[model samples]
Target: MSARSEPNEPGARAPQSRTGGGGAGARKDPGWWGAPPAGKGGGGAGVPEQKAAGDPRTPKRLPPGGQRGGPPWMGAAMPAEKSMNFGPSARRLLGRLRPHRLQLVTIITLGVSSVAAAVVGPKILGRATDIIFTGVIGHQLPAGSTLDQAVAGARAAGNDNLADMLARMDVVPGVGIDFDALGRVLLLALGLYLAASLLSWWQGWLLNGVVQRTVLRLRADVEDKLNRLPLPYFDRQPRGELLSRVTNDIDNISQTLSQTLSQLLTSVLTVVGVLAMMFWISPVLALVALVAVPLSVIVTRLIAKRSQRRFIAQWRHTGELNGQIEEAYTGHELVKVFGRQREVEAAFAAKNEELFQASFGAQFISGIIMPAMMFVGNLSYVAIAVVGGLRVASGTMSLGDVQAFIQYSRQFTQPLTQVASMANLLQSGVASAERVFAVLDAEEQTPDRVASARVDGRVEFEHVSFRYKPDKPLIDDLSLVAEPGHTVAIVGPTGAGKTTLVNLIMRFYELDAGRITLDRQDISTMTRTELRGRIGMVLQDTWLFGGTIRDNIAYGRPGAGEEEILAAARATFVDRFVRSLPDGYDTVINEEGSNVSAGEKQLITIARAFLAEPSLLILDEATSSVDTRTEVLLQRAMAALRSDRTSFVIAHRLSTIRDADLILMMEHGRIVEQGTHEELLAAGGAYHDLYHSQFTAAASVDAEPEPAAR
Candidate 1:
């Protein structure tokens, strides 16, 4: 169905109604409509006015069908501030629960059994009371006489009437109780209790298993989805919010489902079973007990509706607060440099307060449900006592029946309150489910049809036009070629689309208007795994896994032997550093190589790349972060690895790429200059200008004499 036709659609396009200010057929007010004043032709008016038929002073609006400032749907949807609720969130939650049908059945069964066992206890006690009072005492009374009269008759006659009556009763003579029958009933109750306990335990065990595994699977699914999601998805969502969906929200589901599913099932079953038994005991008392059910339900529903909205708001604010904190911490260096610590802290405090308010409101409403349910339960208990007592006193009902009814009444109300409490947890689970499903439902990245073949490392970019967003094209109709065994150095100012160029080569983003090929085969036709495996990269920002140095170096090929790892490290001059450490190649590195210097991290990354032994290598600012000495050593290492391989180097330092076979200087997403270093310097174009402007300054600084004389 179309979104506009959906009953609960959160967003819909509505036709705009033109108001009186300035529209077609209205007299054009120059000041109000951006048109010329009546006498002055053009002035401060908001709308353009039509000129007289032959007037030469007015300018034309445009051709008949010209492009407008924005898309037609710009004003179609309402602002997010006006949203009433998280629409479609509940429906998505239900979809997630659909897979757990069998679990649901088990939960329901255990709940029913537990509730039945609970109700049986009170009924058994009531029956025992009846047997003692009515069966034993009433049977001893003489016919057509009260207990008092019978007592008087027994006293006057003096013939053991009470003893005769007791003997006539069902009680066994010369025994304290009916051992066999009582044993059987007691054993039945015991069995019920044991079964209920086991069922409850198993229910918890299974639900926890389901919840943990489900959440684990969900997190994995989300991670996989993120790997396949279009870059645009990340562009629109905060990194921390997305992280929360996979981490915090999934945790919420695990907690709520694991803890509450069994309780909810048990409470619901108890309430139903107890009510049925109450009606069986006495219809009038049952009616009084039931009167509170609807009232409780109505109040619970009202509270739940409000609570759900508040919970959603709370979660959203929590995500926002987490995002802000993460952003502040991640950019702490910048924050400190700018002296914005107080500003960041104040912003955090504001967001935290908003989260606090939302959480307070949600919890407050949910908290009231339990107390309200208990109050209604108390009132029901009072009514049952007053009415049941009167019935017993008037001789219409026996004391035993009244006692049984009172016990059942308590049974009925307690579960109702329990059920109410369980609702809060269920709502939380639903809220989390909504967040999880939102990610799973997002549009996945498009698949490529390319199949890996024997690549000769010859790469081609053919008339390619690309963009991270349609409105902001990054690479515009540019083309290049890298012959096998050639090193192509891409030089550009920051944001000149240098990284984007190589990213396209790896098929991270598909071309908007052209194609990229390896060995004359379309890159898009190759499987992503096969394509990426053939390429090796050493980035400026290196990430090292938590493992031994040998493991990190040999990560690409897990089973690589000691000889291969050492060989790769030796090629990158990393072996010298490793041998110096106490543990040699066995030294453990912390996550992201926090234990090492930036230059060491770069060397490790290069070693990993060398270990891969790929046909194509991409060095993305590999020497940018290192000192001059480390850069020189890396340059020598890269020289040895570059032979017989197609390599693309994105670099800012001109000295590092002077020996490259080809150099392409980029500006504003286009290759404005291309040649060898010598050829580009001779051409005196953009590259020449950049080289003289940046490198010449550096050289002059180096040539400057120290102020030793002074």
Candidate 2:
């Protein structure tokens, strides 16, 4: 079959060349949306007129300049544009969270309270320590007082007497009393610790409810969109990739929103509170702690730059790996029959290895941020201790203040590191969001007119043409008609657009050029649901969803009565096989009918179609994979079902199409000849050639006398 030229329509164009050798530009052609420049002579005949000559309305192409190919710091294979802006995704995600604003506010409040309790707990303990060691131990009060009395007196005395006594060598209160203010300090620390723990637990509970519910809703919406999306959208995307977006990508988002959000809040609050307390205690020490900020920031920035790229790579490779594994498993039989196990394994292994490398690199880079921050934190702590100790000794700062400053320094560093770690999780979440949004933002299929009503199964194709890609036209200006209550069998060589013809009839794809009508109404103008409701199709590849036999039979006609399902099954001869099984109608089918034989799957599908009771029935190689006995049974069943309904059948077995009212022979996307079986045989054209190719050998064998009764 010769490839047809891209129809020079207003929007037809070869995709633009990629910008760089690899990375984003290599992965996706930047000019994918740009239309090709129109050629001379208004494009050859059969082309749409608007695109025939260069339309003045088309935008002029800009010359490439500045960071168009690759970044200066990156290798030639990595494009500068590989770094996607997160602004749009962030806005979209944040918008989704608006509905749960109250939940988010509560979560953040709990997180901040938790950080406050954690921070203040140590300060309360330090105060109690100073009261016990200085006020109670210095003997400024009576020597032999009870523990409670001593603690009360020490609390009343305050820090002045202690400082005076230490300066003048005078005695302070409660020197001989045991269990002084230290007990109070311990109690206060315990209370704060408990408060922190409780707040954290509550935060987790609330965040979990919000995140889980949100994710569930989001995933459900995505699934709903999948159902509504045009069937042609699926043709260009892998099932595995789509599955990952729904499952893995959404899960990643949940993790990010739930955990990272809490961490982010806690870290920011802790850092702010700690820095304020540190400056109040000792500005010198606070400065020392603040120095670590720039270093930490630099390290985090570098790691984030590298990690983001790695994350993108990881997700891409993961999608590829999933696609390969899914393809291999789905086509296992074909692989085995062709002895391609080793080749398939090699391809899978290669994709898996790529995924592993990308994942490792991404994780390794992100993993460095925490330890790098910690190193800087440790240095800052040492500097704070040295500077504060000297200041206290030189009488510029009090010992209690110096101690508080040291505690605050640690607090500040802790949160900074925590925030850094949380950033990694946030980035990963953003990466997943990018993928999910890509699906959400894809162009929806054009909607048809709403005025078109239900049809009575009369269909006509007028100069219809279609191409999956601009460079490959599978159907070319093909025209045909199917009247009500007529069986039109389509006979064609492989790749002769047989299946595509049925797809058009179903309006799964929009025609590139031409009009298809049903009962004098354009199919495009009809609602997809209403259009498909009147039609039933049994594909060569039968798919059975996970359910019981009865459930599958009544799938298309939910709420159907048991008698109706049974009658439909009987009509397709599925009842006989189903009855042989232990559970009869209760027999279960796995995904895609993996547990059933091909003939049984086909029969079940036929039963499903029969139950739907459509006005138009399409059988695409319905009995191609069945044995002779099964084929004969199916043939009879199909013949019985065809009466008084418009039907389209695509078949290779000559015996199946013998009684068809009209037969159209197709070759290379065009109808070469058309007539009854007898007329085609008499014409000795393409149809005759195909029939003879199959039946000629059988006829010769029959005429050879069957090996003389051996």
The numbered model that scores best in lDDT is 2
Task: In model 1, state the lDDT of residue 246.
Answer: 66
Model 2, global lDDT: 0.68
- Residues 59-127 of candidate 1: C-alpha lDDT, one tens digit per residue: 113213643222121111111221323446545543556677898678666656656666676666665
RMSD of each: 18.1, 13.8
Instruction: Please list the C-alpha lDDT of all candidates, in the order they appear.
Output: 0.66, 0.68
Q: In angstroms, how far off is 654's CA in candidate 1?
A: 1.5
TM-scores for all candidates? 0.79, 0.81
lDDT by residue (tens digit), candidate 2, 149-238: 544554467754433334432224446323555686778788887888788778878877987888888888887776667755654455
Instruction: Please give the RMSD of candidate 2 to the true structure.
Output: 13.8
Measured by TM-score, the strongest candidate is 2
List clashing residue pairs in candidate 2: 13-36, 138-172, 139-172, 139-173, 140-172, 140-173, 141-173
